[model samples]
Target chain A: MRTEAIDPPGISWHRVSPKYVTVRLVQWAIENLITVVVLTLPLVFVLLGWWRWPPLWLAITVPAVTLVLAVWRLLLIPRQVRAIGYAERDDDLLVRGGIFFQRTMTVPYGRMQYVDIGVGPVERGLGLCTLKLHTASPGTNASIPGLPAAEGARLREQLAARGEARLAGL
Target chain B: MTANVPEAGAPSAVPVAPDGEWLRVHPASPFVRGWVALAAIGFFFGRDFFERLLQGRPVFEQDFAGRAPWLVAGGGIVLVVTVLGFILTWYFTKYQISEGYVRVNSGFLFRQQRQARLDRVQAIDIVQPLLARIFGLAELKFEVADAGESAVKLAYLRMDVARQLRATILARAAGMVPDPARPQEAAPEAPEHPVLSVPPSRLIGSLLLSEQSFFVVVGGIASVILSAVTENRGFFFYLIPAVLGLAASYWGSFNKGYNFTAAISPDGIRLRYGLLDTQAQTLPPGRVQALKVAQSPLWRIFGWYRIQVNVAGYGAAGSNGETASRTTLLPVGKLPEVMSMLALVLPDPGTPEPGRIFAAGLSGLDSDGGFVTTPLRARFLAPLGWRRNGFATTDSALLIRSGRWWRELVVVPHQRTQSMALHQGPLARRFRVADLVLHTTAGPVSPRLTQAGLDEARSLFDAQSARARLARKRQISEQWLATVVPAPVVAPVVTPVVVPTQTPLPQQSPQQEGPQRG
Candidate 1:
């Protein structure tokens, strides 16, 4: 899963689980399920002949556009998931993501205050978790997603230990 | 623990002993603190009088003889209760200056006591608000290296006492032990060398030509034209608020920037400014986290520049004039003055030719002056500033320059860099260019170097990371330990930081030494 196009040499990069694509698709489906339900309400009312001033075609436009957007996002999810990756260097950690807007952030071990691991229902079901690194500067938002649960735990322990050892007490 | 209480009417005359003796602030502290309440009371009574006069009901003329007694009695009660509250607050609040910390034991019911460590001192500001100035008193604020909130605030101290206390506290924070034998001479005040002073004319001119003023003018004109075109008088109402707000903001900047002067002393860079409510700020060594030099398109005509800095303990500069003043280095300065202030803060620019490289960072372009600019192929991403936008490195600091019209230069020392980022958007990927951002503490100067070549970005990513690590490991703690550790004759040289790569980017190597500022 090493992307030859983006990964620099000398450091081993770790890609998130491919199953994350499914987790994200499920999460997206759950989030947009509400929009689809709400948008369908009006359409249902019109179909049932319950007082509707708007035309049937006008009502159809709303759900149609929503479905199109949902489909577009569904199509993009896999590549976006593939783009997510994190790397650990000697004295710092690097996290990069985003398809159109690629960003790589480096958080030095000394500046890290603590390490956090997050797991959602879908991620838990897929045996995946997210690892977040906190630094003194609030802007140091370095988080890695779709990490395997075991790998996430290991990385958290390793990062916490490294942070304590190199803590500059910032 | 037991402090001698001065009479509620009499002023406290204790000197800054630093002998672990608790001392009460000026007795008038409470009155000064209660000014808001007094103003509210004045408004209430004055409103009644004004309303009666407006109604032609004769406030003090017709019923004065009968109502005088009741009015006097009610006023007396209010005055008595207010004085009682003041006395209660005054009796409890006390502060102590010891060896390693300054403590304020205050609060009425909760009995709150807060202390700020001497070593953790970030900056000391002596503020004289209009009322305090009239009363010949000042407020001493001790900014500790905590979250931007001021740790210790000693309000309404006699002006002379506040100055002496500040000098004593700063000396202790610097780890200088006062010669106890001479109680009269507590670490003799450090001599100040005047560096630069901004003239009133220049300050006014800068204000008139500032970006805010430009926006205000544009907004005012647009609103006026709209009102005329639409023939709606309602549009005129918006002008009242906008003009009032603009007037208030202009006055704030004027009050804060008037007679701005910067000086160098052993303590740090001392800045004294403000017209009505004067402020003297002392930023000790290592307190400044970053620096930025900027120019507006309009200011280029007069060659005026602005320099601002970030310190750990100061809150972010906002609409408040005091906070804005805290971050400002030179409200309005010429190039030489700006350069001098920069030299003082960084001290070692880590270059054989500091002036030339700085000049390049300010205005040089086309990869001249050791700056690695964006490749020509990527000019499509930023056609206006592709030539001007670039980054450079001296031994101790990273210099980033950008903006074709409103030119800007940011300097972040390797040691002060909190973190860094490398990013490339889809557009940039096409041209094989990326942006590098060096993050410092919370401040206005966001040191982002844009459109660096892809290869250069990759190399810089690894190299800058290594440099930041090495720099942090070597930087000495800001806490001066003069009492224990002898001052080094020469300041320790940080790791010799360069671009690290031997082969410079194509045009960067052939760049000339001196700046060709447009």
Candidate 2:
């Protein structure tokens, strides 16, 4: 495989930090764990004889099935990380990522509603921060999962300045 | 400002002006206010019941022990809550005018910050509920485009302030200054169209003669009787006051309906109704996306029609904000006037053009467009009411179609269309006919003009979709052209530079020399 490097001047770039990626993964795990526990509560009750128990073999089968599903997701995490990438064009920030299907989304600095930068405990431990770009559309939320704290702050400042300039028609 | 104004016959001539005079909105309570009122009432009533219970009083005791103490405590609590409510209502509510927006900030705990851009605001509706009317207060409602879920409500504002804000917002939205030249003109005055006002007697007669109200009274009576029979024998005692209250309310509503008048103005439409809590909503025409003129079976007897519009940012029914329905252009239910009002509020569907075509070939006289096609292979598939389904379209994109046998009439304009859909059921597949529906951004005005012929409908659908897309593209392109400046062209001048000429002339071939000379 061969790769060529292109130097583009006056173009800005942003990257997600490792710490931010770790924080998001932890949050995702916590949320999925809650869902899993809620879904399995009935089976747990059945096994304890508090409710009607399924056949002994079926009872064993259900947990095994759930474990397989959980393990499948755990194995897909690396693929998910590899999918996430960012590129800055002349006028917009492009974030591209999807596990099974690849998608690239562009948010023009002029149209950005706001930028939020925050660091979770996990991200803080890893010395990384997350940057979220919000638009008027409530559902279409975009985020750069991880970036170094210093880089995140610098990107926030640059985005805010660009947004101000656009608003002022400068 | 003068410099920004376009010269005569200029292509882009719309003038952009500075922000208009600022107006202050009325201070109103948040949704939490109603919850607080309910909580206070519940607490007072609950505390009394609990006090009686603690004294070992029977649940059904007519004369309970410790009643006086409980009553005193309840009264004191009510008084305190009322005082607190009054202070909070006065102090915590405030709205203001920012550069190009109306900012409303309210609430004690969960703060709500709502802002509506002056330019985006389509209309201002003022609603006065029964309680607010007594205090000469009104709620100001703003209808804005692209406002999403934030419907602005200014609660308990002075009526004058609401009107002032409405005028200011309208002026700013229409891209004008608050011209001092129009000082004599009242801000909320209705237009003096010949059909604007219905005679007071006729209005009263219509309300009294309405069978709908009669049925409502009958329904209320039936419900009261049913409840009395099912709940308890002792409930009979309460029936007297309840019946009297019902009668009084019926009379009040009737009287309210009597003096009603609807009018269309150049700026917007105004409706005035109600006996106790009178309401006036000024709905600007440009804000209206869709207009619906409806008549019930009973209303048909009296040649009456009720008109409603689909507007954004107006509070929904039973919402915390000012009731938007009150701003209805015509509540008097006069058919001709309703039609004229609709024309004034909605965009023109354009004059009917010749060479108009029907997509659904032909079905029957009763079919929307008058034709139905059945292929030889698909004879088993036929619409149950083929006679009542079809669609027609004009070159300019006005579409009309009808179905449902009992209720019909759907018309739409192509410019407003957002999507086109085709559906096929198993039965439809057997007949080689499918349903084509065209959807628009406007609510209710979106017409599902089901053209019956599958192939023809698909072709027409493709054409209409392409037309709508082209119209949108043209609009965007026009805006872009107006804003973007083209780079100036520089003519290349061949200046005689001895060294440059010597180098270039030596390298040029015969073709190159000819082109350079030309």
Candidate 3:
């Protein structure tokens, strides 16, 4: 029961779909693994005697640096994913995220220009999507990642309806 | 309502009762563009001929006399192609004024249709390019609120028709019916009453008086003299482009600011200026989120100041190369004029002691005003403007006065503030001070207040956040005022007391009472 209480209280904070974790992890692995392979290619070639370097440290240093980065990113992925949450208020929507450099953005409903729902192949497989809210000021555009496909569509429809109504009022 | 109209095709093919009479620009628009293109081509040819002559070549005899027929044929083809392009462009571009939107369709090969909502129009500008002015034609520019990256522009209409269209659009945008019979009569005066004007002589004087122009002219002359004395032809030739570039920019600035005038209008503040090419811009009320009153260092010698505003749609409009939409309210003015312009833009200034606040923000001479000045530690960082770098707050706005040589006073309304944060670097942390930044939509306004004490910064953050939230909550949908007030309801004789359903607006928190002056 205690472990289930993952979200912040009172604000009704909504976490992204749990399937997003697997999608993100797979994406992270693919991206880092590609970089690691590309970076370690010369080292592999050198070790196999296909290529030669005068400095000789090239074989050791490149893979070592790539390995360090791969490990760091692998460690930070879950924390970064967990840090993201969003809440819908009466007049505004709030998005909070970031593991070290924290940010909380409040986007007033009246100022919303449009709402965009985007889905990628992985996200579609996981039944998740992302929502982007745009405003007149470029700095204030807020994006929420990893909502369930059904929830994302519902949110998009509601946000669009609310935007139109508020804009008409203006 | 025209659901049957296909998305892609010539609009003329499926005319569904002609949606409120589509208006095409002046017939001479293509001629204007053709003339401009021809002039450019002539300039290049003339330059080539002159360069050959300067090189001591028998250019006229060899190039023109020998190949006169070929030259004539080539010139004719070029002119024909240019005119063809202009005609195609003008033919494809047309605008339709529907009930709720003004739709402009343009482009020859790739069709582009932009529709600006009638209610969302912030302002309309009438612009005349050098060539267009000669032909008595103008372009209509619409500054539509919240339409990011896309603005509707209908170019090259007769000047009178442009004014009439602007009047019609503005009136419609403000939810007023345009009188059919008097459409052309008072429409010109609706946004064109001259409130102030800068004389041509004064404009020329200001241009020459600026230190940049003086230095450029002097430097060019000095270099020419030096090269002549040294008999260095190469050096002299090299300096020609640089000197000419400076002269051209100075001339451009002069032309852009010539005959500058400001006017009061029902829609907003109207401005008209230019020598060869004229521009008339209306900055609607409530569209201006922030303002900057600035005086460059040299302008201080003549006590001249300039004011600029962060009007919503002005900056984001795609550039038209006129330099008219620079968002300047006052390019050069005396203290009295600047003060009047200030009042015109930010009428409230959100304070009772407006004079004191304005004086402090402009001059920063008085220490007793409500402005919170930076501590002495700032002297090391800014050196010149540190003492005057301060901020003052009102119930609905924030005023920051900064700069020493090039002074600036920025006024940001609370509701317009997008976000705010306190930023402290390592040195700032050591000095126990931080910079407060208030984010705004892109424009000329500086978004930062610097070097406040830690405690003061924290208090300011808290107070500003609360005030901004409150202001946003109470924001009204309309920007204009009605002259009449509704009569108060009279309770029936049978009912002893009338019960009110809605509560009155909430009072400000006691802790957030009016701040005392420093």
Candidate 4:
């Protein structure tokens, strides 16, 4: 028995492609841009004193809050992308992600039921894909995003072969 | 033995369909299915018709005799059409049970064929609805892996034939050779030894003291009091739906747990339960992903406990609101009954002193019996339950206990543990505690040891991964009949190697320097 921490100190982690930062930024903008636009529209009228029906505090606070949340979210994307990493081990795949609420999962090759390689429209335009490993258990959420298509294929093939070799029954 | 049963290696005994040797289901299958729906429809429609007839004025007396023949003819036409529909449906549905697969070809208007590999079967259920039972028939449901739905449902086979067929399938699935020359045995069922039967008294008493009773009783009293005091009738409106919901839940549990009996046969762990519609579920050994023994606060007074399990294909049990009906292993049982059930689930308890660890998991307090408790500082986090919240492990499985009031013990075998995680929130981090969760297939029981010291959580997380890895390699194939399913390549035991380099992260474990290089 050895006393060890969950995040083993020495591991050559494969970081998601740097292009992932742009992908996340675009996704974040798409998600927050709509709310910012809609909420800011009301504030414009309030600032110009065109519509007085909405109370001054309510009109100012709503858009201000949306702007702060959007900017804060935009700022967090790069770090979150940086935090995502997956490592291929001899018998298992280690996936770690999340910035403030960090998590690392160790899924044995034998435990994987299937592997899915998904290329969304945006990721495809960037020549990138996301690889997801599904186990019998739904709780084992292991997905790696922003991989170069070629790298994704290689990982998928390697993972599938290893999974087949170590196939364990449910 | 029934004449319908085929001899081992015989091509077919029952008349084979024109299209190969596929066997047609009993003619009464559609009738049995139709009978239930018809009964429900009749009940509702008859109620309204009878009520209206009783109130209607007497204009029918003079013309009734003249119109009787016309009314009878209309009713006869409808009955003839319905019965013809049922007969046609039954005629079209056919199934072929063979060496490596069970294929079902069914449908009249639009034909559909389905085939599931015998090795992939997760469970076999022999269900006997009240109507079907009257004809001595049962339905065989095949739960296959990958797809959560029952792959093949063969309805209305004679009870004996169904049992014999089930035994054959189990034998075949276990990788037995389909020896054509060997004579087939009459009934292949390995004698089942009954393990536990919940007495009606306990079921009734347990239900009476359940959480629903507590809420209903308190809510009823409060509503009555409020309505009486305020002179308002609005409280009764809320109470109506509450009472109806509570009644439905009670009925569901009662129906499922009635006559509940568990036994171990060669085929699997057999469960016989239900009052009106009896069902016998056969869960093969090692099918269980995880199990939880739970006792609500009210149940604790009577030393009663309930058990629920997670089997791979029973994915919708929780979401469908049939958790109690489908997942319940033991509705209510004493400690001894619980122990026997545990033996069925885990033949190899892995620990020599099983009683000590299990007892600690069930009711032990303060970390006796090799159990590790949440640190004293966790008192601020969970003041009442903190003392009872702890974890213990056997060689094969890990047990986590929590909640002094609503006691629960969750067990997840090492091989079945899909993955694990350690979580530390701002509050838990300040208290130097973290939660460790072992992921398993979807089920009601979630195995989580919460509020453990940070260092302990991390260490357990690492050790758990190693144990799970080894366990996976050693896990036997689905062919339990053939023996252990250990991985083909046996590499010598080595600590899981860390990759040769490290890319620094934002947060590093400052205390992990000693174990880092090793």
Query: Any residue pairs clashing in model 1, and if so which?
Result: none
Q: On residues B1-518, what C-alpha lDDT tens digit does candidate 1 reach at each position? A: 11342223333433344355567777898888789988887776678888988999866777589987988788778878888888878766777776466877776666777777886788899999989999999999898755467898888788877877888888777766554455445555678899999999999999999999889889878888898899999878767877888899899999999999999988888999999999999987767778999999989989999999887677677665567788898998989998999988988788999898888888888787898989999998999999988988888988899988989999988877777788888888888899888777666677888999988888887788888888777654555545236554212212122112333322122221112111
Lowest lDDT sum, 10 consecutive residues, model 1 chain A, at A1-10
lDDT agreement with native, every candidate: 0.79, 0.52, 0.69, 0.77
User: In candidate 3 chain B, where is summed lDDT lowest over 10 consecutive residues?
Assistant: B509-518
| Candidate 4 overall lDDT versus native | 0.77
Show model 1 residue runs off by greater than 4 Å: A4-7, A16-30, A45-58, A78-82, A116-130, A145-157, B1-14, B46-78, B178-185, B219-238, B480-518
Best candidate according to DockQ: 1
Could you estimate the TM-score for every candidate? 0.85, 0.51, 0.71, 0.86
Model 2 off-target regions past 4 Å?
A: A1-170, B1-82, B146-150, B178-260, B295-303, B315-335, B352-385, B394-397, B403-405, B440-446, B470-518
TM-score of chain B of 1: 0.85
Clashing pairs in 4: B476-B485, B477-B485
The best candidate by TM-score is 4
Q: Write the per-residue lDDT of candidate 4 for residues B113-216, one digit (tens) a residue.
A: 78777777787888888889888899998887643667889898878668766876776676654433343333256689998898878888989999879988
Candidate 3 TM-score over all chains jointly: 0.71
Task: Summing lDDT over every window of 10 consecutive residues in candidate 3 chain A, give the lowest-scoring window.
Answer: A1-10
TM-score of chain A of each: 0.89, 0.73, 0.86, 0.91
Residue B41 accuracy (lDDT) in model 2: 71
The root-mean-square deviation over C-alpha atoms between each candidate and the true structure, in angstroms, is 11.5, 17.8, 12.7, 11.9
